[model samples]
Target: MMTLYGRRGWGSVLIEAQLAYYDLPFRFEEVDDLFTSASARKALARINPLAQVPTLLLDDGRVLTESAAITLHLADLTGRDDLVPGADAPERAAFLRWLVFLVTNLYPTFTYADEPTRFVADATAAKAFRARVDDYAQSLWRMVEHAAAAPWFLGERRSALDLYIGVMTRWRPRRPWFLAEAPKLHAIAQAIDAEPAFAGTLARNFAE
Candidate 1:
C-alpha cells in the first residue's frame, strides 16, 4: 500500500480527495504544521526534502511530490479519465491549461503569503507582502472566473480542475469571496463539495 504524508485541511487534502475518488488503498500519515513546528518539518524532510504534505510514497517505493504531478500520476495509474481528461480527449488541452494555471499562478500566493516571514525579513514588511499577495490572488481569481465555464471549469465534464477549485476556494479570499466575485468558479466548487464520492474523505480532512 502507498503512504500519504499530509495534514488535515492542507494541500495534502487535495491528494487525499483524489485517492478516495480513485478508491486507491493508502495509509495516511498525519504531519504536524509545516509553518509552526520544527520537529514536524525535520521528520517529513526525511521522506520529502521540501517537507511538504501530499507527498506520496508509491507502493513501488518511488516518491511523488507536487500535487499536479500526483494528480496526473494517479490518472495514469487508474487508466480512467473520469477526473482527468485523456490524451486524445477534446477537453485535454483546456484541462492541462487550467491545471497548470492553478498550480503556477495561484497556488504560489499561499506559499508566499501563508509564511510571509520566510520571505520578508521584517514583520511589518511581511504584513504588507501578505496583503499584496492577497490582492494579487484576487486578481488572478478574476482571470479564472472569466475563463470558467458553467457547471465546471471545462463545462459539461468534471475534471481535477473542479477538485482544485473545491479545495482552493477554501483558502485566502475563501468561498464567500468566490461566491460573490467568481460565481461560476464558486458553483463548480460547491458541486465538488456536494459530490458523494468525496463526502467521507472531505469530512475526515475538514472535520470541525
Candidate 2:
C-alpha cells in the first residue's frame, strides 16, 4: 500500500487521480495547515522537512516529495510509456518543456499568490505582489492554452500533464477565467474533469 500525505484540493489531487485511474491501492493522510497545525508540522517533518503535501510513502518505506517527482516516479514504477514517454521519444522534449513550465512558473506563483505575506513583511507589498502574480499566472495559463495540441496537450494519449493541468485550472484564476481566455485548455480540462475514473478522487479534493 502507498501512503500519501496531503492537504485536500492541493497538487495531491493529481496523484490521487493517477492512482485511481491506474487502480493502485493507496491511503491518504490529510495534513492541516503547515503553519498553524502542530500535528501537521510534526508529521510532515518526519518525512519531508519542507512540510509540503503530496509526499508519497512507498510500501518499502521510502518517501517521495514534490508533485512532479512523485508523478514521474509512478509512471516509471508502472513502466507506462503512454503515461511517461521515454527520453528517445520525440514528444519527450515537449513533455519536459510543458511539465517544467508548469512546476517552475505556475507552482511557485500559485504558492506566493496564495500566501503573499511569506515573501514580504508589508501587507501592502504582499497584496501588490499577489495581484501581479495573479496576472502573470493568467498569462501563463494562456500560454498553456496556446500550446494545446487538440483533444489533449500531447495529442492523442492522456498523460499526467493533462491530469495536472485539469486540476489546476480550477484553482486561482479558476474555471471561469479559463472559459473566457483559454478556450482550448479549458476544453481539455473539461474532458479530464469528466473522466469517470477520477470523479470520486476529484470530488474528495475539489467538490465544494
- State the displacement of the C-alpha of residue 92, model 1, in Å, after optimal TM-score superposition: 0.3
| lDDT tens per residue, model 1, 1-208 | 9999999999998999999889999999998889999999999999899998789999999999999999999999999999999999999999999899999999999999999999999999999999999999999999999999989899899999999998999898998999999999999988988999887877887788
Q: Looking at model 2, which ten-residue stretch has the lowest summed lDDT? A: 34-43
Give the per-residue Cα lDDT of candidate 2 at 112. Answer: 77
Note each model's CA RMSD in angstroms: 0.8, 1.4
lDDT of candidates 1 onward, in order: 0.92, 0.84
Question: Could you give candidate 2's per-residue lDDT for residues 79-197 as a string of tens digits?
Answer: 77776778788788898889889988998887777888878789999999999999999889889888989788999877778888789998988888888999888888999888887
Number of clashing pairs per prediction, in order: 0, 0
Q: Estimate each model's TM-score.
A: 0.98, 0.94
